[model samples]
Target: MRKALPVLLLSTALLAGCAVGPDYRAPALDLPEQWPEHVLLSAEARADWQQWWRQFEDPHLDALVARAVDDNLELRLQLARIQEARARLGLARAEQLPSVSAQAEAARERTPGAASPLGQSSTDNLFSLAGVLDYELDLWGRLAREREASEALLEQSLFAHDAVRLNVIADVVATYFDLRSAQRQLRITEATAASREETFRLEQLRFDVGESDELALRQAQSELESTLAQLPSQRERVRVLEGALGLLVGMTPAELMAELDYGDTDLEAIALPDGVPAVLPSELLARRPDIRSAEAGLIAANAGIGVAEASRLPRFNLGGLLGSAAGDAGDLFTSAAGTWGLSATVMGPLFDFGRSASRIETAEALAEQAEVQYRATVAQAFNEVRNALVTYEASGERVEAIRRQVTAFERTLELAEVRYREGFVGFIELLDAQRALLAAELALSEAMRDRLTATATLFKALGGGWQVEG
Candidate 1:
């Protein structure tokens, strides 16, 4: 009884022993309390890290985004990663659970006459079956900490997958808008070329009748040739853009152009709902995915510190066996043959080549690295939001300016053409006006496309439209 009392007391002490390393506590992030400068932001964008894609009003875009989120290769890979983390958690949990197994064997032995007198003429066979069990006691909470770390990693993977989804959706929208802009430019160039051809004919007639000089004919032809020369390259740009959009949507380039809708009538309207909300930067610590993932990694590293430290202390295990052994199969489990044993052991690393200390140092370094990564992630997020805000606002102003320029240039071209027809001006004057109008038209289409793209970028930066589910 005295011996048993010491063992009991020892067990209690072991269980109460401190976990060797530092406890995990998330470090406080030093972030902005409010926007530092005047930002062109809306009040409607909240800290809902998901659903950033819905800010684009196209139903078609929304549908494509939904499809990609469910099937994108990158997102699927992250999902698989989360599954891996879950498996690791399960293995860690099982560390403290007992393991059971069955064992069986059959054997025969023969002895030579010269070896021993008793075995000189004898041969025997033996068979037995046994049950076995074993378990480890996590007295220092090492296994428990490991399981907790794995669970955190699983959540991190999930959030990472969501980040990928948001990124893909944004790409598709941006590329689709690009394709439309190219299409608009292509059609504009074609129309301008046709107009120049008519002007060339008129100038040729005037030169024949002595109404215009050779220089006028040459300038008119130059404008027509230049406008016509742009057609093939513009067409090529459209094809390239079509292929890009196809890849973004996860389809073949040929297939994308074959069924692409590039007309403004076909393009869906995207309404800018709102801008970044007025929220504390610290609140965003819970919203951003990369930030969350880094935090989880830091937690995992902290847990490893405990795991490594605990290795220096003794670990206890429970071992047991239950079964019967017999020479004859039918005799198994008889009272005389039945047997069972239960035992426990505590083992520790008495000596090592500084492995435990090295592990603790490595874990501390990694946790520190994760902290830096979290800070960097937040900084990058802020940069994106700031850049998106500036671009979106600038695009709105540029579109308006481009439209006005197009209108003024168009009226100028019409007046120059009327003067040339009335014999009050030469072909060069009309050609210059037409060329200016064409550039303005092209510029306007580009500005509109930029506006649409900038809107999508801002929404993505604000984490505007996704609904992430755990």
Candidate 2:
């Protein structure tokens, strides 16, 4: 036994030396060094992006984001998945260690008088106390590969949670902006309706005095009704957006409706950061959580190939039992009653209709699929960043253009009103000017909303914050 122990130790040391299967190497990406039209933002601006919602400088928005992070159901579900993965990792690690078990036994037997040569009955009792140790030698590194794959899966789950968090923050900010835009449009439409009503009344008075024709009065009434028609639809849209934002913060729609519908908060007061820092395309790929998750999945799959390969080779195990047994319970611990034994097992596949080879093939195919998926994830991340940048840049220009148009239309409305009152122009001309001004105002509001949303989307594409905890 002593000689066998030394040989066993030597074999264990040698078997522990190398794990079978391909080691993970991060795949190379063909990427550009810099983003197109990348803006060099100030360090202060870049820092603000770490918690991008804080850049808006709205206390309410900050509160909402905090609530969403804490209470959101989908995020909680991901956290639970991470816990499950962590538990699986623990199980995998445990497989590498030996298992020990305690055992106890008692037996009572009687010899019949007929079977006894002396014509006497005899009774005997037995007791035992023992322990068994069972351990796999891990000769082919199957356990090691399984542990490695489990670790990679845990990391993948963590990255997936982070990706979901990033999307949630972005969605909340964008949805809030949409709600504000809708509210502003609703206000603008209501005011236009009031102004049109006064214009209609004035035209009716003028017509009663024979100073205006029926056509003019009818045109004024039509404009007022059209402005009024927009209010209910706009208000309904605002309510729907509120319900959505409420759900994101883990509140029921009915519970959140009152708080959102009755607020007098001005959307214009929501201040956003200017000139987001430009990141290199290569750097962007490394920071994105979805891409990182995909890479981890590939690593897990690669380890899976090793595990499958190892399964085809011989398996080694060592088992032993140490115990004491005696007819009298008190003698169970005595040296005279002591017993011990050891065994070694070597197991390998003889033939299984190519099952082992088929497993290797399956593992290889999965690894290949994971690699392609990782590449596809990287490509998708790049495309999203490019599209966001383009939209942000274009949306800014659109806002500027709409601003100028608003100014021009406002001035034209004023001139038309004066000309109509002075009898220098017909009411049709004034009505046309009013419609143009209203459209421009609404367009300007929409453009501003788009600009803010585009910036949020870009921040999301850039992976927002990197301080995610696992």
lDDT tens digits by residue: candidate 1, 376-424: 8878987887788788889989988988998899899889978988888
Residues 1-470, candidate 2, lDDT per residue (tens digit)? Answer: 88988798697769875678888888888998778875557444465467877877887778889989998888999999999999999999999999999989999999999999999999999999899999988877899999999999999999999999989989999998999899999999999999989999998999999998999999999888888889999999998998898888777656775666425556778785677776667777678999989999999999999999999998888889999999999998899999888888889998989999999999999999999999999999999988998998899899999999999999999999899889898888998899999999999899989988998898899888634323
Please tell me which predicted candidate would have the highest lDDT against the true structure. Answer: 2
Name the lDDT value of residue 26 in candidate 1. Answer: 77
Q: In candidate 1, which residue ranges exceed 4 Å CA deviation?
A: 1-18, 36-52, 109-125, 252-280, 423-425, 466-470
| Candidate 1 weakest ten by summed lDDT | 38-47
lDDT of 1 at 14: 75
Model 2 Cα shift for residue 404 (angstroms) = 0.2
- Any residue pairs clashing in model 1, and if so which? 42-275, 50-465, 50-466, 51-465, 51-466, 51-467, 52-465, 52-466
Global lDDT of each candidate: 0.74, 0.88
RMSD, model 1, all Cα superposed? Answer: 3.7
User: How many clashes in candidate 2?
Assistant: 0
The TM-score of predicted model 1 comes to 0.86
